[model samples]
Target: MLQDYTIKKQPTKTSKLIASIEFILVLLAIQGVLLLFNQEVPTSEVAQFRILANSNTAEDQRIKQEVQKKIAPLLDQAISQSTTQQQLHDRLQHLEPTIEQLAGEYANGSAVTFEHKAALIPPKRIGFAIQQQDVYDAYILKIGKGKGDNWWCALFPKVCYPEEATVTETEEEPVKFFVWEWIKSWFS
Candidate 1:
């Protein structure tokens, strides 16, 4: 006959201390990873960019003002010096083709739109014109040229081939067929 003996074991204080330390280390590591995942960049870099842009814009304006001031006297002197109607007529004649083209385009049914830099024109000067295609079809128009190089950078077509236009059959997802309407509607 064989008798089996079962001994009850008690956990030591050393084991408890080791378990507590391991728990604390795991918490610290978790916190560190969380902090890394949700890291916040300092605002000082954004502030610096804003300051630089403002300074450059101010400088550019100052330069333009100076140039205009310097040229004003010369323009006045040239006007005073010239007495011929022939000179004035010649200048007008040069611009006559552009005027005629603009007038012709306006007379025809076309989608016309213009872009300008921010806050250049007063709201009062902004007027809407609609060109009719038939009795019910028409497109709204706005006319103004952009002032800055940056404005035209995206607008102008380059030597490279244009990106392929995506076609959507769904009525909800409208595709652009006209340049002016597309651009105006996109920004607005």
Candidate 2:
């Protein structure tokens, strides 16, 4: 009996194209899921207080610090006592004059203005939580030109200082995705 040999046919162009498209689709799906996972969710409903400095000079920076020091205690007290956003807003509004006076005194009579608005704040580490870039209801205390770096803290939740804030174990742990891990294992 003669020995038989078999020749395997090469994949067709269409089949190759389909395979490439399928691979791309899988990649896109994975990317989409990862993007979704990376999305940041606010851990708590809280308001932010941001104080912008007039300039980056030593004097301006010192003034900003002084203003923050004066306002921190008052903010902490008001925020701790308030329960809702409205209450916090009302409290901040009530304290606007006092805050302005403090800022003005430290900033050499620099015009101080208070603005309440939804602002896009960048990623920040507030006490124990890392906040992502998102729009938040903020009480902005603009000093003088309002053209310098800002100091921000969670005013409503009273997480301004690390020592004063409490962090749970779950909050400190990083987010895990078992499904993503399995998918990665398959690729590996």
RMSD of each: 23.4, 15.2
Tell me the TM-score of model 1.
0.20
* Residue lDDT tens for model 2, 1-188: 97999989987766666766687699899988766666445634778788888987888878888999999998999899898878888998899899888878888878998899987676676554468767788889888997665444534223333444555213557767875665455445
lDDT of 1: 0.35
Give the backbone clash total of model 2. 0
Q: After superposition, how far is residue 6 of candidate 1 from its true place, in Å?
A: 4.6
lDDT for model 2: 0.76
RMSD of 2: 15.2
Model 1: residues with Cα > 4 Å off, grouped in runs: 1-6, 41-188
Q: Estimate each model's TM-score.
A: 0.20, 0.57
lDDT of 1 at 186: 35
